[model samples]
Target: MAVSNVPKYHIAMFPWFAMGHMTPLLHLANEIAKRGHTITYFMPRKAQLKLQHLNLYPDLITFHTITIPHIDGLPPGTEIATEIPISLCPLLVETSDLTQDQIELAFRANKPNFVVHDNAHWMPRLAKQLGIKSICYDVVSAATLALVFVPGRNFPKDRPITEEDLSQLPPGYPSSKVVFRGHEIRPLMMITMPMGKNITFYERMVKAKKDSDAIAIRTCEELEGKLCEYMVAQYKKPVLFTGPVLSAEDMKTPLEDRWDKWLGGLNPGSVVYCSFGSEFILEKDQFEELVFGFEVTGLPFLIALKTPRGCATIEEALPEGFEERVKGRGVVYGGWVQQPLILKHPSVGCFVSHCGASSMWESLMSDCQIVLVPQLIDQVLNTRQLAEELEVAVEVKREENGWFTKESLSNAIKSVMDSDSEVGVKVKNNHAKWKEILGKPEFMSGYADRFVQNLHDLVK
Candidate 1:
């Protein structure tokens, strides 16, 4: 690369230890590197291994591993948070805090202009000690962050959040109403406000917000313009929106692969690609119901499910003869697959998702209609935005008490897949509109450029 008038920077990134968190940070790091900056990414050893397939720029991006110090209650070899149950997340946070000394040592040896960290509370304080500017990079939606970080809106500091608290609107955000049901918020509170921890997840988020010089979120104004505007007013900080950060390179997979071959052979707009991400572990009964729902649809479908802990294979968890019953029409994969590639396939018309922010963006870019079946934290919030606000997805209606039935699942799938239906037509049109916006290079790259320019100003 030739020298230019633009100033180059050395930035360090530290994201929470999960694939969902690490992948976005990696994409942002690549974006920054493309502008001729140097990045030193800090991650746990096991998490770093997952990036082996990514075609990162070696000259500009460096991976530095932080050895995870073991906690007593955490299981052996569980270096990453997703490897264990959500109940153990608080211990994972505590273990991440133990890496403070190691991270500080790395900073002292090679100082950078700025450090970017995620929801970890200790990072801003550490960056302050090193006299480097700190930027909080949030991977979740802006609406979720607005509820958590805005002053006086968070849960009471002294007590855990209750069902009543979850139902009401957060303080200071009167215009933003509560959209999550009590059942949806129950699991979210369990993950974020775990018992016996000295610091609650909400408190950690508050600290990170209060200590950072500025904030960077992985979204665009197009999707969450109102909430982003509200967050800027509430926090009184420089809020930068890095729109999507998607690339074709990240979605690449061998076309000749079995999964690709099967998808390619199907008719366009005929298949539903279902995945619940890596962290969600479904109960046997719940898993069976989902499989049966897909079988009832009788449409060509592909599902990628995470193997539950102690389950030797997908077969052990699956209903007897379920695969045989759906043979030639549906295929189930136990482990990971190239999700982006599948979504981009012409045969895939709908994405049956857990409503994760990443999956939402991928579906939008691929012009695939969404069928939301949210499982855990922030997913419910994402579902609300897509199904209610954006009107680009149809959520599966659960029982009055929040339990899902196979009938409801099948109905939701059919609603989105039926092109002649009113809901299906609207969803397809909305998805296409967003896809056109996301396809433009200038629209997405503009956000990254603004982010880097703002960081340059902050450091100067």
Candidate 2:
């Protein structure tokens, strides 16, 4: 790097240890580095290994490895949240909290002008102590944050928060279309519950928002204008967006040969590809029903998900006679495959996803018709953004028990895949409209440039 093009300012970032959180922060880092700014990324040693490929500008961006401190219940090398059960996530948070001193040392050495992070609310306090500004960046959808976690949204402390409370829209919340239902609200119940050393998830997020100099999310005002406004008013701080920080040109690696050969053999826009992102393990009955649902669709399909409980592999969890019926046409893969590439494949026409924030952006940028089956709270909110607000996707109808029937799953797929279906035509048209706007280089890059400028102004 020449002195003439030297980085404008130094910034450091550390998101939660989960790949879901870390990957988005890294994507944002990549965009910032593109504008001749330096970055020091702090993440778990293992996540760095898995995600180093995303560091497109190594000359401008650097990775500093972090090893999670050992805790009693965690295994010898438990470094990330995805490797363990959800119940054990609190332990991971506790371990991450133990690293305040470690991060402070990095701060002292690197001397970043701004510290960008999530989960580590302590980052704000630490940054202030060292004369660095703190930027709290959220990778989750804007709608989710506005509806669920905005200030003044917490239930009264006198009584416990019920499912009813979770289902109700927050006062002055931007949308009623994204409400949680039935057992789907169970995940939100733990938001305020104490985890490590009595620090609740709700409290951490509140502090991160309140204490930071500014807040940022990976979405722009065009798609979520009202929600962004709500954030500014609620938090009473500067809010910024990076406009879906993903680029197809950045991921140069071609899809692996085996997947290429299989998908290539199918007709264009004929295959239904399904993945729930990392860390979701479906229960036994839901897993079997989900695969059975695809079988009923009678479409060429690929499902990338974990084996259900009591099963060692996807093969063992298969219902009897399942293999014989769908051997050539359907694949139940239990391992990680390159998701972004697979969605871009020509043969993949319909994507059945868990409506994760990353998946939502990827699916929108692709030409595929979208189908959502959201499991977590953020996912549920993301589903509404696409299926209800934007009208570019259809969420599979679930029963009152929070489980979808195979028929419902099959119906949603057929509705989107069938050319004559009304629902299919509407989503396809809406999805194509979004795909065009998001794929434009100038639109996405412009947001990134302005975001950096905003930070620059903060320091100046």
Candidate 3:
């Protein structure tokens, strides 16, 4: 078809008000705009500012900021997930839901050909009333969606979701291999917890998914086809995939000299780099165990983390005389470090990650030997996909109480770091093989093309 013959789309997106949700949606927006479609992205004032730098095709992707209404529990002016503690997120959700009228007004004015959203269960029905096709986008791991949070997962009678229940698999679940352990069920178990006066988290998710015109996920069909297919079967809806949708700007950006000069001085493939995502603030005990675990490895290490609870800083949380003992070889900083560039460093041979969906893809595409220490439910299932299904990473074993000791964490890292160990060599080669395939431009771009096509199909 000629340029004039192509049907140009104007799409509206209203992602959940979290950094994790917003970032991937922006990446998808970039992909859509690259193909000459127009996007009207709706977000809170603070969030729109944060994502401004990432909007590669500014001419095509226009942002429309909406006011976050005041809620009693939410601090004044709290607009996004980063501004408040995780416990206060439900309040944030309530605050954001107050913007539905503003959003509906924009939809009526812009008259976008389609709309995309997640979490906000009311979005699909609103899209219908406004005559816009709605797509429920899953930006997390496909395995996480398929295994744990499948709609209609049963509980005995009207009882609450427990760790014991989570240990058991839901019927027709695609993969039994992605099972959750006792300690790893908290994130999932929270689904039954109320997110609103009238709605539970699981109910919100089921409504968003079931009511949407189509289900879209940030994954490659090649990588997670079975899981994506399982979603189609479970929801009885068309499931479209968007590959990893990693930021192009991130790949183009260089590692800062602060890290580059330091990491360069070390031997190749000798350092252990560990980082959980920004949201998880550890308990002081667990924080110390993590630092000690890296310390006992005797390898150079970098740990980027938020200050643990009850401690003012990482320094205060350290074990006695710990800084002096490992002075030159280790550093624990509470600031943000560029993970993708850090993983690409020559000295960084192993990655101990929490396996958040974005981090999971970054680790897979890097040369580092993968080691997982999953805390949340999504991270746990992502770990299983990499460790069990893909055989590309090693997961640290937690105790019966759902906590890991320094010894267990140390052993998990060493198993994949030591060349003589069978597990080390196995994961190394597997990681490299996966890296080659996922790193290819064609493989990543193909999914984006198909995703946009699906959008066209739905609207037509």
On lDDT, the leading prediction is 2
Query: Per-residue lDDT tens digits of candidate 1, residues 125-235?
Result: 888888989998998888777755566654654655555665566645533432566354457565346433587676778678778999889999888777788787877
TM-score of each: 0.94, 0.96, 0.96
Candidate 3 structure quality by residue, lDDT tens digits, 239-306: 99989988768868889888999899899999999988868888898999999999999999999999
Candidate 3: where are CA atoms >4 Å away? 1-6, 156-159
Where in model 2 is the C-alpha error above 4 Å?
1-7, 156-160, 249-251
Quickly count the clashes in candidate 1: 0
Give candidate 2's TM-score.
0.96
**Residue 3, candidate 1: C-alpha displacement in angstroms:** 13
Error of 1 at 205 (Å): 0.8
Task: Report clash pairs, candidate 1.
Answer: none
Angstrom error at residue 94, model 1: 1.0
Please provide, for model 2 over 151-209, each residue's C-alpha lDDT reduced to its tens digit, 9 standing for 90 to 100: 77756566556668777777687777776654555676567776676777788787789
